[model samples]
Target: MAKVSNILFVHGAWANSSAWEKVLPLIGAAGLTGTAVSLSLTSLADDVATVKRAIALIDGPLLLVGHSYGGSVITEAGSDPKVAGLVYVAAFAPDVGESAGSLGAGGPPTRLLEVVRPDEHHFFKLTREGVDEVFAQDLTATERAMIFATQNPLAGAALGGEVTAPAWKEKPSWYLLASEDHTIHPELQKKMAARIGATTVTVEASHVAMLSQPDAVAKLIVQAAA
Candidate 1:
C-alpha cells in the first residue's frame, strides 16, 4: 500500500480554503491531517503553483484533492513526485493542452456560467441568482449566502490555462460525482472520471458536495489515502 502522509485540498473558483471547512474536521477525526490550499484564482499556472507550494510544506506521500477548477490544478500539480493519488469532488479533469474552459464547452450547457458576471478587471463572479438557484441550490439558505459573500472571483484567464502533463496519467484517483450539481454537469463529471480511470462514487449533492455531504467526501479522501 502507498504510505499517504496527508491530504491536500484545492478549492475552485469563487471559493477559498474554507470551502473545505466542513470536511477537514472529519478528516482529522480519522487521525489524518488535511491541508486546504487557497488558490489566488488568478490563472491556471498561478493556481497550480499555489498547490505546489502547499505540497512542498507537507511531508510524505499526499492525496491531492480538488473540486471544480481545483481539479484542473491537481491534474497539473499532481505530477509532483510527492503526490500519491488524486480525489476529484465534482471537479474537472482536463487532458494535455486542454483547459477547464474548453472541457466545459464540450459538456452539456449549464446555468451556472450564465449567471457569472465579469468585471472590468476580467475577474468573473457569480450572481446571487447563480448561488441561490444553480451553483448551490441544494445547500441551506445560510450556506448559500456564505458562499456568495465569500466568493473569490476567478480571473477570466484562469479558465484557459491548459495542462501540460496531467498527473492523473500517473497517479491513482477517485472521483465524487455530484448528481445534482449545477456548476459542472454530472455527465461531465463521469466523463472526466472515466477518462482518468478513477474509482467513482456518486452522491445526490450540489456542486459543493464537501459541505453538503462531508461524511461521504471525507470517506473518499480517506479511502484514497489508504
Candidate 2:
C-alpha cells in the first residue's frame, strides 16, 4: 500500500468546512496534512468539482474523508489517480446511477426530516429543534448552537443528482458508522459499507460524529491513511 500523504475532507449537506474543525488538528497531530473543502451544496456536480480542485492542490497519495453528502462528493471525485483511499464518516455512499435521495428513499423517516425547512429556492435547512435534538444530539449545547448558526442551506435538488462513477469501486475504502445516527440510518450505513466492500467500524454517536467524537473519527482516518 502506498503511504497517504494528505487528507481532504468533504462535509455533508447543510454543513461547511467548519464541520471538520475538530478533526483537522487531530489528523495533523498524526503527521498528515489535512484540508477540508467548503462545498456550495447547490449541486452534486459543483461539490465534486470543489473536491477535485482540492485534490489537484495536493501531491502524492491522498485520503478522502467525507461526512453525509460529502461521501457522495468523494464517491464521484475520488476517482482521481492522486486519491489513495476513502473514509466515509456516517455518509451516503451511493453507487453509479444512484443518487443520495434514491439511496435514502426506502429508509424510515427520521426526526431530522420532520424539521427540515425549505426556502423558496429549494434549499433545505434544519430547524433549531432538529439540530439540538436529533442531528447533533451528542454535541454540547454551544456546539449544537454553532452548528445551527453556521449551517449552509443545501439545495434539495442536489440529493437527486446521480453519480456517474463511484470511486469506491476503484479505491481502498473505510466506513465509520455512527451507530445512533438519526439523519442517515445506521442500518443504511451498514448496507452501503457492505456493498462497497469497505472496512467498517461502528461508534455510538449521532450523525455529526466528527464533532462529538472527533478522536474516534480521526482514528479511523488515520487507519485509512496508513
Candidate 3:
C-alpha cells in the first residue's frame, strides 16, 4: 500500500469548507492529503464529531489545521491518535480549561463583532457591511459579498464550551499569526502561541491569512508536514 500523508483543514465560524478553496490544492501538491471540514458552528460537540468523521477517513499520517473557531475544533480533534501535527492559522488556540467565548471576552471588542445580532434562533452573524470591511477586506469586493451572502451563522453558545483536550500540548504545533488581524488582537495571538510553545510565523495581513496569504500559509503547512 502507498503511504499517505493526510491534512485536514477545519474552517472557522461565519465560514465553511469554501474558506479553503485555494488552500486544499497547495496541500495536495505538498504531498499530503487535504480535507477541509465544514464544522457546525452551532454546537461544539457537533463540530468535534464532524472533525472525527473526517479523521476516520484518513488511513495514514495526518496534519490537522484549523482557523478561528476551527482552532478549538482541531485542538480537540487532533487528539486523535493518527494526527501527527497541527497548524493554527490566525485561529483560537485555547487551553483545556479555556473556551473561545471566555478568551475573546478578555480582549478589546473587535469592530467586526459589533454588528453581530442574535436572532430568535440565538445564532450570531456579521452584518453585510461588517463582513465587507472587517471580515473580508483582503478579498475582492465580489468575493467578500459572495461570502457575506452565504456565511454561516454561529451559535453564541459554542464559544462558551471549553475544550476537553488541547492538542498543542501533546503534538508539535505551528501558528500563523496575522499582524493586521482586525478580529483577534495580534497581541493575544502572540500570547496564545507562546503558551503552546508553537513555531510562529507572522504575516502582514488580516485575520484570514490562509485566504489572503495562501502561499505563506501553504508553505507553513508544507514545512510542518515535511
Candidate 4:
C-alpha cells in the first residue's frame, strides 16, 4: 500500500483547528493529507487524548504538528507508534516532569501575562490587545479581530499538567522559531528547540507565525514530512 502521507495538526491555547487554515491548503497542494484536531482546551489530558484518537484513525505513519501550547499536546501524544515526526510552530515543548507553566519559571517572561484575564472558572482569556499586539501582531486588523472574537478560553490549570514522557525524546523534530513573538518569548523558543535537538528554522513573525508566514511554516512542515 502507498504511504498515506498524513499530517495531523494540534492547535494551542485559545486557538482551534481553524488557526491552521492558511497552511492546510499548502500541505494539500504538496500532495499531503492534513487534518487539524479540535482540542477541548479544558486540560492537557483531554487534548492529548483528542490527538491520540485522531492518530488512531490514520493507517500510515504521520507527522504531528503543534503550535503554542499545542506543542505540549503533541509532545505527549506524539509517542504513538504511527507518529513519524513532530513540527513545532512557536510552541512549547516540555520535557519529562515539566509542565508548560513550570518550565518558564525564572526563564524569560512573555507578554502573554500582560493581557491574560482569568474567568470565574480556571480558564484564561486573552484581551483584544493581546490578540492584536502580542499574539497575532503581524496579521491584518480583520484577522486580528476574528482571532480575538473566536478565541477559546484555555483552562488555566492545563498549563500545570506535567508530562510523564516527552515524545521529542524519541521522535525527529523540527522547530520554527518566531523572532517577534511576544506571547511565548523568542528566547524560550530557542531554548526549547535546542533542548529537543530539533532541526531549527527561524522566521521573522509573531506568535502566530503560521498565519503571518504560512509559506515558511508550510515549507518546514513539508520538510519534516519528508
Quote each prediction's TM-score: 0.98, 0.98, 0.95, 0.97
Candidate lDDT values, in order = 0.92, 0.91, 0.85, 0.91
* Clash-forming residue pairs, model 4: 68-91
Q: Candidate 4, residues 38-135: lDDT per residue as tens digits?
A: 99999899999999999999978999999999999999998999998899999899988888887656459877788989989979999999998989
The C-alpha RMSD in Å for every predicted model, in order, reads 0.8, 0.9, 2.2, 1.7
**Top-lDDT structure, candidate number:** 1
lDDT of 2 by residue, 49-109 (tens): 9999989989788999999988999999999999989999999999989988888886666
- Model 3 quality (TM-score): 0.95
Query: Which prediction has more favorable lDDT, 1 or 4?
Result: 1
- 2 or 3, which is superior by TM-score? 2
lDDT of 3 by residue, 1-226 (tens): 1233788899998999989988888887877778888877988888999999989988877888999889889888888888888899998888878888877777666786686778998999888877766776788888888888988999988877789899888998999999888888888889888899989999987788888899999989888887
Worst-scoring 10-residue span by lDDT in model 1: 1-10
- Regions of candidate 1 where Cα sits further than 4 Å from its true position: none
Q: Report the lDDT tens digits of candidate 1 across residue range 1-226.
A: 4857599999988999999999999999988889998899999998988899999999888899999999999999999999999999999999999999999999998897789999999999999999998888888999899999999999989999999999998899999999999889899999999999999999999999999999999999888888
Residue ranges of candidate 4 with Cα displaced over 4 Å: 1-4
Q: Which regions of candidate 3 deviate over 4 angstroms?
A: 1-4
How well does model 4 score by local distance difference test? 0.91
